[model samples]
Target: MKKINRREVLKKGVTLGIATTGLTGLMRGRAQPKKLRIGFIALTDCAPAVMAQELGLFKKYGLEVEVAKEASWATTRDHLLSGEITAAHCLFGMPFSVYTGIGGPAGRVLPIAMVFNNNGQAITLSSQDFGGKVGFKDLEGAGKAILAKKKEGKPLTFAMTFPGGTHDLWLRYWLGACGVSPASDVRVIVIPPPQMVANMSVGNMDGFCVGEPWNGVAVKQGIGFTTVASQDIWKHHPEKALVFNNEFFRANPEESQALTKAILEACKWLDNVANRRTAARVIGQRQYVNADPDVIDARLQGVYELGGGLGRRNYTDDYMLFHRGGQTNFPRKSHAIWFLAQYRRWGMLKEKPDYEKIAEAILAQDFYASVAKELKIPLPKDDMQPLGGFIDGVTFDPKDPEGSIKKYKVREL
Candidate 1:
């Protein structure tokens, strides 16, 4: 990796890194770039980028920004690759998938920052099958319910936003816990979040794992009921991030760091409870999620509605996290390890990899740490280590990663 001379960067107000060799360095150092083009699909998860742009966070951080509303995740990925957009509010697994040549680009893709962790995401089941809410206080019960459904000679068809995305992993993990082999027992398909309700209503799918707004719409329309929340499946898992092409980072290191700082500031602003209402309103506008503020606000403020009529008025206090005092964006190697383990377990990665090396190469924890320090955010001595129960009834920790992967009885890689 090329190193940026901090003193020189500070003096010049522009990146003079390894990529800017000779003539290019001499020519471009005279002026700063005017605008940063950011691409985003219209989803509630893209709120931070919207908020950052609306609240002047980008401008406050010395950036001229263009917020490009994209039509699809594929379009956003393409824009990033073609240098049409500087960065994107992208799927968490997108960079990984691209880096490993599993999706999108056939080469490496890098993400500058993780946007948020754990939000209003859920797996919803069609109400055509069950008129009332189905009870599943435990993973065993959920599993049995799926088995019973399968035994009825009708297999469950589920949808996720993108293959290898957070929704995909959560849906797979939840199903795998229920003893339903995602590959065999259930037909898993990739459907954009906005189209989930239409697909379910059209009978193309029986259920779907998706982010908010769509889930809320499905419930409000009485089409389906949410079976479980993502938190219930795996609490506080990393969800989405600001993804970029690796070449973009190589060509613009200073711009990359500046972008990270701008985003980090934006995250802090969003987490302020006082600003949440405004954040919701801004994100709910047509330019962003293009949904009702009430629907968006319900989930943003911890008011959850599990379809078929379930949930407290204010269910979870911290459903979506921005920055947990440096806990939010810093890419922990262990977190990357967990994702890799899941990939292997789900057959996305066909082999047990050199987890440490992959984690180090792709996660960019060191870059995140440096940016955090530059912004004066309090850095945690170690990444978060939470002891929690997974839907599969398996326990996990950083120390016993292999054991954790092996403990899942229903894992089907």
Candidate 2:
């Protein structure tokens, strides 16, 4: 609740020996970091930033950090542009959109590191539209029912978090793939993740997509059911990352690296499978998601509860492990490319972007690679290349994106 400058925190902490001056001095000399100001939304995925600071990970690296809770993604992006905050726990394709100028205007945002992957994100459907299936039992079947209702002159209404965030894309992609045109066949609306359940209760939206504790809240309220997960759509799909303005990273390279190192360390702790329950409790605290431990704990450990008889069980690839023995946080170039292609597929990008050039500019693979090497983490065979794959039977190749774009059975942007 109290707002203070990053330097002030450092100044106060250093004098009291709460945090060493050595780390601060190193960063100041390296990046001339005036202050390590970072912002985050109230999502569980933003845990690393909170955990890092709370658990002394940042102090260990000599970071005088200012953690601010942002109200919305648009506000967060604006703060990043004006330098109000140095960085943020941001949406996956956010930096790419900022660079391409699609979401707001290109060339305004840059990503420093992918902090985590495969966290809590889901597609929820209202009880009216639940129809008794759970956990992607029949995406096609759901789409067909919605479409049939539309043809009878009743188009199903759906909701997503933001215009360009992953929830929007996933909801659109899933609906489009099921022979339903998201833009045409169904009315896709924008609702904040926190408001998803309340909006569903109004009988306005037949389904919605958002990240957790929101999804779990819907299931608990008995207003909606978990129909699909972002990870389920594409196993191990990239979720959230640490994004910043390019100017920040360019100006404070060492500080950026230091922050990345600190976050990676926090990630390692969170991914230790054994630490899942503890991480959940920490995140569920008022500083982060502010939800009950039960809601936060289950999904963080990949244990799922489907309200509509999909049954309860553990998902092997639900949440991402960013720092587990160093496998979790590697910012692979393929990850960035996949997001770009998805942006193009959704009409966020009009042209067939220069894949390699775009990937190099937005994704900090070189930076990540150096840090990984320094820590003795093995690099993937190809760092700046694309990796192709099939999602729900649709093949996507980053190399031949133009063809891949055309091959999509759904609507093309």
Candidate 3:
């Protein structure tokens, strides 16, 4: 792991020659707001927003920021929509789900300001079922065992954070890849991230897919083991993103850009291996993730215990990354289209959606590009890219989402 100097990083960000060129001019003659309210859930991926508040990055950008730790993703969505908070550390699929009115009535479409982190979530299985036989490769046997249980009139249940969130998608994809039907073989339920371990301890479900710390906590408590880290399902997959209300973004472009820049710098600082320990400690405080720092730190450093005496292994490349070579932060339309494709594949949407149009509306690419250029962050040349391969050997083309949907053998559609 390479060491990082926080002071030097901050100096570079603050001293960027073009930092104040075009965007800052929008703030001229406008009264600077006293404070910006942001929301976050208790998860490891919320590091960027929490770190920005703790490390004074938000203040450094001449913004007084208030960070609110919310109880659930639903609360985060409601607050973001009702103007209680201007932006939030949001699930990647949340903005689109709300826009399309899948789980409920349609609200104002939200836009992703930037992607906060990627590739640290996991799918955990209860120890009681597999008897130490939990791994992605064993999903077929697991499905058989689940079928046997169902034959006795007890269906296996699995949980994810939200209906259309990344956790839900990962769990479904993994189950489908394993030749198990997510819709038929098991009962999929919704459980909050922080409550996942507790619920599993009470034997509420057979397994769950959620963000880190909880998965580590389950392993520590002797209740479950990780069947697969999400990265194994899809390496460098997009996870939580910094999302804002579209109306708020349009109404306050300058403030939005400033906030985005602050988070981008905070993300860069977080990627430094040297800062991870302290980052874990700060994020572990009561108002943030509120978990044991050691548990959070373990996964943050790419160290996995896997519980039940599975021993320890280090995974350097596939851990949670806030800013990895500046590739993680860009809000790519391709990623949005992929989510839309999943929604269509899983029958979350009634009919095929205008993939490009909805992606353009919900992902503020122009604003993100402007901020990236201002911060000297290198941008990807094109908006559309292949799904980049999956554990099931299925690749999706963003250009033909319907074709991607057709490739899924176990889709609801």
Candidate 4:
């Protein structure tokens, strides 16, 4: 991949030239409908799909898109596989899970269209459990407290959205960093994003890792305090993405490209600081995130109230971003390699899979590059690179994923 200067492209005022009309115009000769049914969970990251629909970007791109709100990540994955929905606002690691048959059936490959956003998800702990002052930096103390509770025959439980999703990875990494074995030292459960607050409110889990609005909602309800934002774990890390079934992508390549272009436009629109307020208001609707607009707006604007007397802070550098200098939307092969490495570390895979082959198979980097080029979006020079500068002072080299995993002492394998 050649590195194209995004600023130069923007300076030229280039638009999604052929993508806006090329595919849809050609499909007009056929009897197929231009309509598409897309699936999304009620989280702030779903903004691109919702905003694309609300702002008429889909229509502008000749796609009649129907945004379906899903109950959970599992349901979204199943719908995509069953062809009920064409694509999804999806977890970054989901396509890999589907490909490896971790949570779903084996021997199926799903395609990731593009990463929708980054740096927004968070880990939240119950304020009641920690007397209102525990966070990632205090994880060692938190771990000892959790162990003490476990010694009393009551094991502490944590929740993530899915078994092999972004939330699961963040929770596992955070726990492991603190010397708490996610598989042994605690009981981990799968909970949907919308259900996280309700479950925690009733004391179902001691802590949870989930996407935005919910984490902010937990704080609003006085149930949990924000331990750390995912960005704090790894700055600008890949979060949610747009994923499609391989069959769907093959059957409707033009339509897929059109959808991607629409969402990409939406992403560019979202990164603007001025649009944060409206974006929060729109995604907060009942048919979408179904949460208080103020709760969503706070984090969307990079304003935080950790709750339970943890204090408030403004984090311009560590907020959720849909497009930060044209970097957030590309689906890097390195990101997939990291996910596979973690799966191997935690015993999700029996052997080290061919990371490059799997990443190339699932992430549609070629298509993304084509669409990006057409839209004049700058492309990174390398598809694989090192992800560094973690809160734990650990570095992940995509070239040596196995070595990266070996460096961790708290993994199952």
* Residue pairs with backbone overlap in model 3: none
What does candidate 1's lDDT look like per residue over 1-413, in tens digits? 12222343335443211111122332343225569898887677777777667655566555788888987676777788888888888877777766665666544556645555555688888888654536533456566666777898887788887777788889998888777799878788888777888889989988888888788778888898777778778777778888776677777766776666667766776676666666667677776777777877777777767666555435555577777676777777667767767788888878667767666677766777776766667676665364465655566765566667787877766
Off by over 4 Å in 4: 1-33
- What is the Å distance of residue 224 in model 2 from its true position? 0.9
Candidate No. with top lDDT = 4
TM-score, per-candidate, Cα-based: 0.87, 0.87, 0.92, 0.92
Model 3 off-target regions past 4 Å? 1-31
TM-score, predicted candidate 3 vs. hidden true structure: 0.92
**What tens-digit string does per-residue lDDT give for candidate 2 at 1-413?**
33232354345442211223235455555433345788887777887887777667676665788788887777877888888888888887677767777666676656747646554688888776765632454766787788888989989899876676777777877787677877678898877666677888989798988888788887788888788777767665667788877787888778887787667766766676665665566667766677777887788777778677676757775465555455457666666777777777777777878777877777787888776665555655654454432346675666676666677788668
Could you tell me the TM-score of candidate 2? 0.87
Candidate 1 off by > 4 Å: 1-31, 105-107, 136-138, 311-313, 384-389
In model 2, the clashing pairs are: 99-107, 100-106, 101-105, 101-106, 118-319, 118-320, 268-323
Worst lDDT window (10 residues) for model 4? 1-10
The collision pairs in model 4 are none
The better-scoring model by lDDT among 1 and 3 is 3
Global fold similarity of model 4 (TM-score): 0.92
RMSD of each: 8.3, 5.2, 4.0, 6.2
